[model samples]
Target: MRSVLVLSALILAGFALSFAVSEYTLRLLNMAVIAAVAVIGLNFAFGYAGLISLGHSAFVGLGAYGLAILTTKADWSPWLAAIPAVAGTGLAAAALGYPLLRLKGHYLALATLGLNVSFSIVASNWIELTGGTNGIAQIPGLTLAGYKLDGEQTFLWFGLAVLALLGLAALAIHASRLGRAMMAVRDDETAAAMTGIDVTGVSVTAFVLSAIYAAIAGCLFAAHVHFVSPDDFNYAHSITFLSMLIVGGEGSVAGAIVGAALLTFLPEWLRVLGEGYLAFFGLMMLAILVFLPTGIAGLLRRWRRPALPPQDTAAGLDGAVSR
Candidate 1:
């Protein structure tokens, strides 16, 4: 019931913003929706399964390039291309996860970081395939019922719909047994193993799920911008995605969305500060980290806590006087 309300509110809010904002703002909103999708996926890996992956952007890049290559080179439809691109990325993650998941903490982080760098190197060097730094251009936009969704407002609506569906899916997973197992594994792998949970299987599942989400985001990016390049999905993007997950509230789906929106618009908002905008932004983020350690969602949750009723308060006061 709560999830339904939240999803409805999100959709309604997106519609409201579409009417309220400029085209550029709508485009930014679309990007936020896209980023939210990726960040929610990251929550599964980093927040639930406790995987420190710095290579998430690579999975996103794979999806984008996969779609780009298929649609451009193979003359396939965008819809048809997305299936192979997303599924293949998931498979790649599952395959890589078996070996990479063995490393823990910073070791895992570095391994994934190396993976992102390797992906960038290949994308940059493989001029014939990736178009090198120039990127794949003139890519086609997505169509629905023969109506091309090329406008920023139309794309924003489509992206919002996707984000809503995926967000609901994430919420469902968060309430399931698999979600609990992932959290348990995150808390303590040895304890989870002692309780008969397959730690490795859970980790790989989380990684694959995150990869699939990243793939969807990548596909959206390709369709929206009609371009694919290594620079767009670099290590910096992975770091930003991770930061979004953390800033939104590590384990919460709502947090992912909120964090994505906040970070997406923050720099733009700070630009009003001129030359010292970045410095102010950094300090503001630091304040958030220090004061709201659990992120925006955490702050909301705290605010939502029910207060004691007047009768209950009176009874407590009377009991204290009697004592």
Candidate 2:
């Protein structure tokens, strides 16, 4: 209940703020919301399931391309196209996850990274399908009841609604038995397996779930930008997604949202520092890492708790005597 309230408050705040901000800011917010969805998905794999996936961008690309190809080539509606695109992306993840999830740590990371590179190569070379380096343009925007969400402000609201529903779903999963199983695997796969948990299955589930979320984000990206390209979903974006999870708080839904918003807006906010902005940004990130190793969510958790009073040895002895 508390979690729901917190999430609702955050969503309400964002919705309210959207009206007060400039169009540019609203656009940024939309991007942040999209990124948040992907980051939250990453939290399932990297955070809960302890999977290091650099192939996340590839899944997003698959989704974007899937939607783009369906809507443009097949003349399918955006709403209808999204279902197969997202599902196909999840299926791809499930198919690849079995073999890839066996690798641990850097091995898994490298494998996923290679996957993203391969995806980029195909997207760039397959000119007939993905539009090559030029990308697919004039893709249709999303519509609701004959009203097109063509404006940034309107789109932000729609994105926010999507984010809210997905966020709640993620929170529900986090508190479920499966979520605990994933955490168990993360903490100790050997122990999890010994306790009757199917570690492999859990890993695959997490990967597939993450892919589905990425696909959703990709669909939204294509619809929002009306463009799909290889450059937009690359290895760098995968790294950025992981970075967002780390910066926000691994294994936390709120942390994912916070991290996405922070990283998305940080660059824009730092632009005021002139040419030295990037350097300062790096330093700021470093400071956060050094001081708040558990991320912003951890710091907030600590801040919310009341301090305990110091215990006296005499009182302890008295209590002991009474017992």
Model 1, span 180-221: residue lDDT tens: 999999999999999999999999999999999999999999
In the range 39-72, model 2's lDDT, one tens digit per residue, is 9999999999999998888988999899999999
TM-score of each: 0.92, 0.93
RMSD of 2: 3.9
Off by over 4 Å in 1: 306-323
Model 1 pairs whose backbones collide: none
lDDT of 2 at 293: 74
lDDT for residue 8 in candidate 2, whole number 0-100: 88
Clashes of each: 0, 0
Which residue pairs in candidate 2 have backbone atoms (N, alpha carbon, C) closer than 3 angstroms, thus clashing?
Answer: none
